[model samples]
Target: MIPGQRSRPEAEALPPLLRPRRRERPAGRRGGSALVVGLLVAALLLALGAVAYLWVVSDAWRVRAVEGEAQRAQLVSTSEQLQQRVDALQSDLAASDARVEQLAAEKARATDLREARDR
Candidate 1:
C-alpha cells in the first residue's frame, strides 16, 4: 500500500456493476395493492353470479319435473274417466241390439199372419 492512501476492503475493491441498487416507488403510479384487491373483489362477484345462475337453473328443473308429474297424473285420471264412459256406451249399445232383435221377430210374425189371411 502507499504511505498517504489507506487500504480498501475486499468488497469495495470489487467492480461497481456487482453492487445492489436502492429501492424506490414508481414515478407516476398509485399503490399497486389497491388494484390487486379490486381485481379480487370483481372475481368474487363474478363467481357469486355464476353460483346464483346455477341455483336458478336447478330450481327451474325441479319445477319442470313437478309440472310434468302433475300433467301425467291428470292424463291418467282423464284416461280412466274416458274408459268408464266407453264401457257405459258399450252396455247401452248391447241393450239397444237386444231390443231391435225383439222388434224384428214381432214384425216377421205379423207378416206371416197377414199373408195367410190374404190367401
Candidate 2:
C-alpha cells in the first residue's frame, strides 16, 4: 500500500491523534494571487504611460521655448529699426523748422525796406 493511504478499516484502527483527517477544501490559493499579480501589472503599465506622457510634454515645452526666444529676438530687432527711423525723422523735422524761420525773417526785412523807401 502507498504511504499515507489507508482503507477505512485501518484508519479506524489507528488512535485518534495519529489519524489523518479529511479536508473540505484544497490547501493552495489561485484566485487571490492571480488578482494581486493583475493589479501589479496594471500599475506598472500606468506608471510607464505617465512617464511617456511627461516626456512628450517636456519636448513640446522645449520647442515652444526655442520659438519664443526667436520671436523675442525678432521683436527686439524690429524695435531698434523703428527707433532709428524715428530719430532720423526728428532730425529732418528740426532742419525743416530752421529753414522756415530763416525764410520768414528774410521776408520781414524785405517788407520793412520797401516801406522805408516808399516813405
Error of 1 at 19 (Å): 16
Residue runs of model 2 more than 4 Å from their true location after superposition: 1-29
How accurate locally is residue 6 in candidate 2, as Cα lDDT from 0 to 100?
Answer: 75
Each model's Cα RMSD: 8.9, 8.5
RMSD of 1: 8.9
Output the number of the TM-score-best candidate: 2
- lDDT by residue (1-119, candidate 2, tens digit) is 88899746687789998888886444345666777899999999999999999999999999999999999999999999999999999999999999999999999999999999999
lDDT (Cα, 0-100) at 50 in candidate 2:
100
Q: Give the residue spans of candidate 1 off by over 4 A.
A: 1-40
Native-referenced Cα lDDT, model 2:
0.92
TM-score, predicted candidate 2 vs. hidden true structure: 0.70
lDDT of 1 at 68: 99
Candidate lDDT scores, in order, read 0.90, 0.92
